[model samples]
Each structure stands twice: as C-alpha cells, then as structure tokens.
Target: MALAADFRHRYVTPEASLYAGEPTRCEELAELLRHILQMVDRNTPFRHGAYREIYEALHGFLHAGIGGSAKDGLVWGVKDFWAVWESICLVHVVNQNPGDILTCDMEHLPVLLSAPERRRAWLKQRALLFARNGIRRRPDLVLAGGDDIKVVDFKYYAYMRQQRRTAEADEIDKIEKDYLSMEAYGLLLQNHFLRNADARANRLSLEFWLPGAKAARQPSRQQPPWDPPLSVVHLPAEDLLRGYVALYPHLRLMR
Candidate 1:
C-alpha cells in the first residue's frame, strides 16, 4: 500500500479530517500523517512517549472539527505538528551518519557548580525549574559522535495573524520561554559534557522552524555564563534540512 493509504488504514478514523469532505484540509492532514509515519519508521530508538502524545493529540484535533471547540484543538494540533517535524529532521540527520548515536528527552547531565553541596541542590531543584517554567525543558535531540556531542532543540510557530492578537501574544510568550530553557540546557552541556578533557567541544543549536514567518531571520549566537555558545537558526519548516546543515555542517561530510 502507498504511505498515505497505509497511514489512513492504521490511524485515521472516520472522524478524522481524512474523511472530512473538505478536499484541501483532508489532503493536508493526510500528508502530515504520512510524514509522521515516515519519521517513526526511519528514526530508531524513538521516544514512544513523544510519538504517542503527538498521535493522540492529532487524533483529538481531527475528531473535533471547526464546528466544535476547535480553538483548543488547533493549539494541540500545532503542538503535535512541531513534534512530528522535529522527529523528521532528526531522523534525516541520523540517517546521514549511520555510526552516530541519537537520543531523545535526555535529562541527565553533569552539574558543575563550585561546591558539591551546590551541585546537589541544583540537581534536586530540576523539578522546581520545570514547574517554574511551566514546561518540561530538555534537549529534543542529542547527537553523539566520536567524543563530540550536539544538543538540539526545536521550536515551531506559525506566522502571526494580525487579527488574532491574543494568539500572537501566546506564541511570543512561548518563544521567550523556549529561549530561556535552551539557555539552561546549553549551560548543562558545557558543565557536564565539555568539562571532560576527552570530549569534543561543540555548541548547542536551537532551530526555530517557523513556516509561517514573513521573512527568514539571520542566525544569532549567544554566550551564557559557564556555557558554550548557543546558536539560534530561524528558518521556515520547508527548509529544515538546510537549517540542520547550517547548524551542523560537519554532518554533510558524513554523508
């Protein structure tokens, strides 16, 4: 069976957009479903929790059409879209280097606070940090190769529709929160991974894949205290592969 057909057979229900009469919406949903399945198939050692979360979230959105409470549904649908998008990008990079190891939701990292007591306090406060942020902050993908490690976090936001001021504000808030979380992750990587003499030094990269943005923004670099540089790449979702290459040019040599 074709990929789309196979996905529909496995996951799509009569309530899903695939069965909705709208041609354009149906086609778009079908393509997304297919892309997600392809990502799952290609990316071994995938996080079952993330996959399941996205799958269920999409299902809920499809079941609740525009006629219903679609506002919440759209929020969840886009959330899952980003999850699937990140999976697809990570899978492509992993395929390029067969020998490299990729891990998802990597939470444990060395804490290099000056005092041993401080290190323990920081470790114990991880839960508090997450609670304060209102989101679980962790690297979406971790690539380890030849003593070098690359930490990547993915952010997706649709371009702001001028009419929806509230939604735009929410997205802006999310973007800021993600940036702060990424900064923390960068610090963890530097103190935990790069502190070792044998480890290869590399910076953490945040790929903000905004498909709806009006224009592409230039990549910016930031250096946080006790952390290596953090590079932020703003690109459209269509250019994820290009963004990946821009962030990690070394991956091209592996191909």
Candidate 2:
C-alpha cells in the first residue's frame, strides 16, 4: 500500500534531468490532491492486478540485459498512469504491429536550440500545464500515415462500473479529451520539426490503446464486466487540444 520508489531511467541526459525536475513543483501538488480524491473514493480500484502484470513485463524488458527485472505482483498502482502508457507503447510502438513506427532521431534537435540553456528554456516555456500531461511522458512509438504523424500511449484504468448500465448518471464523464492531447502533440510536432520556418512540414497524429480483459463474471454492481471489445480511443488535433486545455492547469503545477 506504500508508494513505489522512483524508478526513473538511470541513463538520464542533462535534458532529461532538467525536463523531469521541472515538472515536480506543480505536478507534485496536483498529485497530492488526486491522491486525496482517490482515498475518498474507496470503491475505486486505484491499483489493480492488471497493472502489476504490465509493469513486471515491462520492467523485465527494460533491464533484461542489465540483470534486473520488475518485482512480482502489481508493480504499479492505478494512479500510475505511466505504467499503462508504457504497456500500450510496448505492444503498439516497440513491437510495431498494426501501427507503423516512425524512426526519426528526436535527440538531435536540442543541439540546434542555440545554447544548452536555451533548450532548457524552450522546454520550460512549452511544457504542459494540466492533469495527465505528456511533455516529459514521451510515448514509445511514433506512427506516420499519409500527412499525419501519430503518437501512441498505452493505458489501463477502471471507469465507473455502474455507468455501464446508466448513461451519464453513474459512469465517468467520458468525453473527447484524448483527442485534445493528440492535438497538442500535433502542434508540438509542427512547431518543433515542421513549422520552425526552417523545418519541414510534419503533420502529427496521436493515438492510444486501453486493452482490457474480458470479464468472466456476470455483469453486476460489484463485479461489472469489461467492455466486450477492447476499449480503443483515438484523438485528432482538435480533440487533443480540448483535453490539453481541460487538464492544463493541474498539469502546469507539476512544472
């Protein structure tokens, strides 16, 4: 029931170090609030068995050659959004299946950021300010289709079970938020790689997967079943922006 110790990658670059640290202030506070909310919602499954399955698998893959692996059991809690993101990316991005992967080297861009200090400054200026921000949480795969560049983040979470039967009254307020995040990323892609006047046009598209196991139990208030098919959500530029705006304030506090 204790929070997990930080498991950030050890091979942190100066940019990465600066990037991660910058979000701590406001994001930490927002997280404290979220934690309190979760405590009040005891019926909620903040951490579940599914999360542990994905985390351990991913930890194994990351440190397989380094002589380490994730511990057994749920290695992450429900609030640990990154764990879910990584899970989706591993299947869709790294594996490069149904989704095509873009292989451009993104690290080289910072070299042209005038001075190292300028790169840091640019990141701070553009960092997201909202809940579930992805400025530092870069996805695993970049997909290019026609004129669009799609970024994928994997996720897993239990929405309100009662909402399954009663629309709006019981279920979580599912909206077009995911699309908004993708839009923000699209804008970022355009600004960073395409719209810099000197850069090329890279119209980016972002997408994600929320894979859920089919429920073996009967549908009921206590043991609601997962949706029959996998719950896959895709967001375009406009939708992504909305999600960003909605979550931006809490997100900025992190930075």
The TM-score values for the models, in the order shown, are 0.40, 0.30
Local accuracy of candidate 2 as per-residue lDDT tens digits, 1-255: 123223223222334432134557435544543454444445555657876555554444332322224322112233344453343233233223433444321231212213446435434433431113433534334555555555554444333122232444554344334434444555555556633562234344444444334322222232343211112443232333244334424433543
lDDT of each: 0.47, 0.38
Q: Which stretches of candidate 1 lie over 4 Å from their true place?
A: 1-61, 64-79, 106-137, 145-148, 158-172, 199-217, 221-227, 234-255
lDDT of 1 by residue, 134-225 (tens): 65554565556666566666555444221212434645555556666666765655555445643444544434444433335534433232
Please give the lDDT score for candidate 2: 0.38
* Model number with the top lDDT: 1
State which candidate has the highest TM-score: 1
lDDT of 1 at 164: 16
* Candidate 1 local distance difference test against the native: 0.47
As a TM-score, model 2 comes out at: 0.30
Ten-residue stretch with the least lDDT total in model 1: 106-115
